[model samples]
Target: MMAGTHGQLWYLGMMEENKLKTSEGTLEKARNSEEWRCQGLSTQRSCHFMAFPSFEHVITMDSLCFDSWFTPSWLDEEPARNGFAQDGNRCNDHALPPDATAFVTILRNCAKNKDLRKGTKVHDDITKMGLLEKCSDALVTMYAKCGALSKAKELLELHISRNLFSWTALISAYAQQGLGKEAVDCFEKMQRAGLSPDAVTFTSILKAYGSIGAADKGERVHDEVVHQGLLENDVMLGTALVDMYAKCGALAKARQVFQNLSSRNVITWSALITGYAQQGEAVQAYACYEQMQSEGLFPDAKTYACILKACGDMGAKDKGECIHNEISRQGLLANDFVLGTALVDMYAKCGVLVKAQQVFENLPHRDVTSWSALIEGYAQHGQGEQALKTFEQMQGGGLAPNEVTFTSILKACGALGAVAKGKQIHDEIARQGLLGSNFLLDTALVDMYAKCGALAQAQKVLDELLLRDISTWSALIMGYAQQGQCEQAVTCLEQMQQEGLFPDAVIFSSLLNACSHSGRVHDGHLYFTLLSKKYGIKPDLEHYACMVDLFGRSGHIDKAVGVIQGMPFSDNLEVWSILLGACRKWGDVNVGRWAFEHAIQFDRENTAAYLLMADLYAAVGMHNDAKSNQALRMDNEGLKMLEVVV
Candidate 1:
């Protein structure tokens, strides 16, 4: 009995030892399998169940267990009969795979399709299988692609062993969402983790830098690309490099990379063209477009849009019309609202309001941009009533006017001196909260008030602005000048200079006009001298004309003649007319006759010269010469009327 009891104890002890060894072996196998899975996941391709050799037997067993769960017949069954239904509970009795590779595949598909609902369901399955920690990177990628950035960030933070794939996923998510600075921060953290970024990673970060105009960061990344030799044989990276540099306003570098590229596509060409267009290098943009066509690369909708913008910038109406015809041929305008808007803007900027309206009316859908473009064209062309009508129509169509729209319409009101309309627009602008944030809008408001002869209102708007640019100061100064408030205009000029805002040609023109209207000859000469000497602004024809009017208005005929003679260009009949008008004003017949003869000699059809000469002759009692001048003016007027009639 004792020997039998001892044998039983030994047997029990041996059985316990074998059980312990078996448990240790299973735990070791699981750890090894996890490490293997991670190594495969770290590769470029998606992680597949077959990639994990250690888990193959387990996956095969799970596949058998869940064979009925994924069958074609099951997929076609009703929601209550299928185990894979989004809300069904038929699969609750069966256990899913430990690694959840099948669900991961489904999540990847959901991400590709951008289906958040299915992705969420797959994530729930992953969580229930207790595979969330292992499959965190896949979840991040899915959430990122689905635009669920918040959920992606949560998963990224929860994952402890955040590898290159994990970091790249988050960085890409930030970039796609236009969170450039956040993407850069993630890139820095990734580098600190001692993992080198691949070409795709570099491209994503470059896009981020481009979107935010972070040229400094983009340059650093370019250096990295050079060091890694990643630009060779990588067309996508090369295109991204070109796009980044172009968008960052480094056109020279962009061109260098583009020329050296082994391959060039429409995307790179369009990027370069867009850069030139945005920089106002319209000639270069057109040249690039022609060159692209010569190289047999057709323009896409974006490329066409960019070139149309270039045409508008340069006022190349013929080029714009040609592009319009091409776009119509391609049927691009039928469905592409952006392209249609570009067409409208191009026509409006080129001073072809009729064409702009035709295109606008033909558009299947018109956004605020289309309406704003037409309104701006009318305003710019001094068609105030038409602009207001268009604004009302836009409002009637239930489209809210944006800042550009309001600015255009306000300008129309100012041009027509419609004070009531201007006030109503002002209320709307204030209600939109656009006044405080945008200096341009505020300047527009001041200009509107000033143009309407409401100097006090203009001054109030100027004073309330938190920040003021040269345009803001110039607008108020011009307002005072137009209202003959010469003292206030000069004071504003002094204040603007004291505040370190250097006056440009526009401000100088306004100042000279103020002096001319107020008969401040000395101040006009002083400002004219300061314009050239202090500010280095060469006087254009407008400035010279203002000076002639200033001298002529102040009873300085010889000084006015001196200005006309001193002008660099001699064919300016406007200046001569100013002198002639000044002679008539002060009754200097000899100088007036000389000015009239010279004006007619320069431009034989100058009606102002003829009219001024007739008035001067009549003022001095030269009735015969006055009749001759009047007859000549009548003949000119008859010819003009005939031309119009024809």
Candidate 2:
């Protein structure tokens, strides 16, 4: 009987073990079924229920037991289709228990769709079910992704158990929206919370550093990345480092990170190339492109655009044309407006207007950028009439001009001296209400009026500006100077200085030119001294040329010669030519001869100097010398015509 009892006890123990195994297997099967149901729900197009048997009794018994749980038919379903319900009132209003998986799936779907309304509704349901803490990270991510950062922050603060994902989502939202400092602060808070940032988090924060030009912050991040051994293991993170440093103008550091990258890709090369291009380092950009090509990495649309921009910056027409042909060969320009615009800009800046216009016409679709590029090209090349015509065409095509377009066309008007068109533009500017706020447009208006010889209008515009920059004052001063109104120019200069605006080189050049034309020798001397001593401005070649003209025009030939001797620039024909013309005016034969020789020595093909010399000899009754110079002038004119015809 004892033996029989021992057997029964052993059998009972075996039976209990088998029952436990069966229960555990059922739970495992239920969890797998729930995962499958969630995946199916995520992919569904519309809300429709399908019974999932494996999820029956999936929850632990400690929670409210259910015979089965209803997986919401589709997480991404439109609320309108389902007759938007509040607080746990989904599809059938069958109150499902607060399941972490269900809440996570719904919140993630809301985040993916960027539907803040649905996300908030789901959050309300989660709160009603008393599972807010359990679903806090998902809710935070949903809010952050939907661009409700304040709500995300409030939710995070409300929860005592903030996870890494919640913090990362908030930081990413701020970084993506260009709130770099806020993102950095979030990062610090995350570290203080004892959560180590992963690679994705690092990328987001590094981008924040790049956006704000915070190279120092990026460097510190680099240290963290190295400490985490992320650099060698992840190319994307390494590329982010290169891009971040490159954008912050730390090319050396960028290059160092780039070289250390174990694997290089097209994106990595493009980042370095774009950095150099943006900094106007054309040679380095081109060299990087070549190296990338040698490595068998094909150039994409972005890479082509960046290199084309570099070509534009350097005026490398030959290189630009070659790249253009390659782009055409690849059929890249058929649909890429950005690449097409870059091409137009390149040709225009290189003085190849014909090619620029050809590219402009060939563009499949032209946006404001294309039109602006073509207009700016004409304006820059002094073809103001062409620029104005293009502007009219752009308007005819139903494209309204933006501020950039207006600025370019205004420059064209100024160049052509079209006062009526300028006035029309002024009216348009007023209609757009741009005159009161856009300082650049206002300055452009002042420049247009000044260059069109409308001094009063220029002054009126200047006076109307609520905030006047140095360029504004300089424009009016230059207009007065060009009109030989020395007193007005001087008064404007004094007013500008009194307004705490320091004069730059261009302003001084205008003042000196005014003095030269109005024969204010003493005033010119005083201003010249003030330029170096008071303003601490070192005179450039143009300033020195203005001085030479000022001295030579007022019968101070010796002083002009002295100015020329003291000039730092070599091989300048303008100063020597000015002296020669002054000698002709003063009838100084010997000095005229000396000036002519020196001018020709510096610029052998200067026909103006030859003509001046012939006139000088004719004024002094030297017939043979005059006839010889006149012959040389005629010969030079013939050569010019032949070259033009060729």
TM-score, one value per model: 0.76, 0.74
Candidate 1, residue 122: CA error in Å? 6.9
Give the poorly placed runs of model 1, Cα more than 4 Å off. Answer: 1-110, 115-197, 211-217, 314-318, 569-571, 624-646
Give the top-scoring candidate (TM-score).
1
**Candidate 1 Cα lDDT to native:** 0.77
Stretches off by above 4 angstroms in model 2 are 1-103, 110-167, 170-199, 223-229, 361-365, 396-400, 423-442, 463-469, 487-501, 621-624, 628-646
Best by lDDT: 2
In the range 379-435, model 1's lDDT, one tens digit per residue, is 998889999999999999999999989889989999999988998999998888888
Per-residue lDDT tens digits for candidate 2, residues 136-253, read 9999998998788889888876773348888889999999888888889888878887788899899889988998999998999999999989887788898889999999999989
lDDT of 1 at 9: 11
Poorest 10 consecutive residues by lDDT, candidate 2: 5-14
